[model samples]
Target: MDNLQKCPQIVDILPTAEGQVRPMTKLEPQEQHEVWLRAVELAGGKVPTGRIVKDVVQKIMERTKVPNTYQIGEVCQILVKDNPELRGKGGCWGIVSAVNEFSCTLRMWDGEYTIGLQHLKSYNYLPAECEQMQVICDACGGLRLRINRVYSSGLEESVQKFLESLGKLNRASLTALEEKLLKVLESEIRD
Candidate 1:
């Protein structure tokens, strides 16, 4: 690994699916070694990253344990604590329409999203509450055709907090809040 040379910058070399190619140009030999060392520590394995024959990423993924607790039609909020790209969707509720090894297909108010298991937080709600949320979820699923935009900074954060609050409401409180939320959504559609 120490003797590895920096590759050329020109289209460099395209890797074939059947062949073994290394990303020598992506990092210096020493830097590559450090990255591999870190990966080994993170994966708790002795796989060398400098070699192309080793499936380092696959091995790491195989060792990852994301519990499958999501169920179809269940209401859950999207968790986006560490995913900055998903900030706009933080705390957004969705219906789990499908479940896989490490993720779920969610039907949201704006659209459908395939979310990782770690990005889900289940909530226990009444049947009426589920019905109410389903309406919002459908609206959101269709909003992609109308609004077709991501939530902005202040709006995203506030929306997350607002939805979070809704989950904590009692039956009486939920009725009023759900009505208000539906009214707001309905109003938005008219304009």
Candidate 2:
């Protein structure tokens, strides 16, 4: 016991490079308890229950994790915060025309632009809303294959209809005039 006072003590241990330390070594029970107590103190002195902590972690992951895949026809908004090429396109909504592993081809009002998945945010619209957006896009000459060729004055009518329906789509509600216009267009297409 007299030799203990003469022994050298570890004042501070520097962080070693990752994997240089014994990565597979397990902490002793007492050491683990000490670590847990430190963590609790760091976390506002709250003693977290296991089930509640697990649920909170899961919710955090769901809210923070970026989606790995995007589907065609999904309505998404372009995020230009970190992308220089997408300037002036922030808050602009688009439809996904093609989907790649890590990117998507978006069809916007002016033209189509290929953007990365990280720079796109889903609008989370219902299937009917998506279909309505597609129709509106088709009328705007984005998807020409599905567009009806009926031209009132060299595509002027289609352009006007596209603009009119855009407002209704955004609000998800149609005025009386818009309902009449929709009926007229539907009958015109049938005839």
Candidate 3:
């Protein structure tokens, strides 16, 4: 176990699918080692100087700048690797309710959050997929409001708070039974 702990962690290159491929550039072995060392230091929270880190980050940003920024109504997945506020919303999908120069206000299942561009990844979903996701979010919000109205035969803040506490149910994909239950809930809310 001690020997295992001494081994370095290996990073897989391009482990996930990306919308665009970055142009490959050749680097000497020494250059690659230096880059890896700097990355490891950053990951370990050992910043020698904020200004140096900022400059390096800016250069990297210039190289990897997105051609088009997010637009309103576009769907994006929240990347919470470095944002403590978005701790639990690591890969949750949200719709862009508002777009700013470097951030977006996303309308998620639970609520709206304004997140920086660094903490968002475009879903690159098809138009139909995006439309369906919007419908799901709208339906969920509408159903929650209806439930609040029906609870105790009046609109109640306590009921709304309780529903919000459910918080997306943390299900990556719905089970068949869950899908049926959602359909039933929607139908009940409609009536």
Native-to-model Cα distance after best TM-score fit, residue 88 in candidate 1, in Å: 1.1
lDDT of prediction 2: 0.55
Write down the TM-score for model 1. 0.45
Q: Summarize candidate 3's per-residue lDDT along 72-186 as a digit string, tens digits.
A: 7888988875347886677777899998765789987656899977788988888887888777777677554543344434334664444334444433345686556555555
Better of 2 and 3 by lDDT: 3
Between candidates 1 and 3, name the one with more favorable lDDT: 3
Clashes of each: 5, 0, 0
Q: Model-by-model lDDT, in order?
A: 0.54, 0.55, 0.57
Per-candidate TM equals 0.45, 0.41, 0.48
Higher-ranked by TM-score: 2 or 3: 3
Q: Which RMSD values do the candidates have, in order?
A: 11.7, 16.5, 11.6
Which portions of model 1 show Cα errors greater than 4 Å? 1-66, 139-144, 149-191
Sorted by TM-score, highest first, which candidate order results? 3, 1, 2
* Model 1: per-residue Cα lDDT over 84-178, one tens digit each: 65666776777888998878998764457898665688887776877777666554443333233322222455654554444323222336656
Superposed by TM-score, candidate 1 places the C-alpha of residue 103 at a distance from the truth, in angstroms, of: 0.4
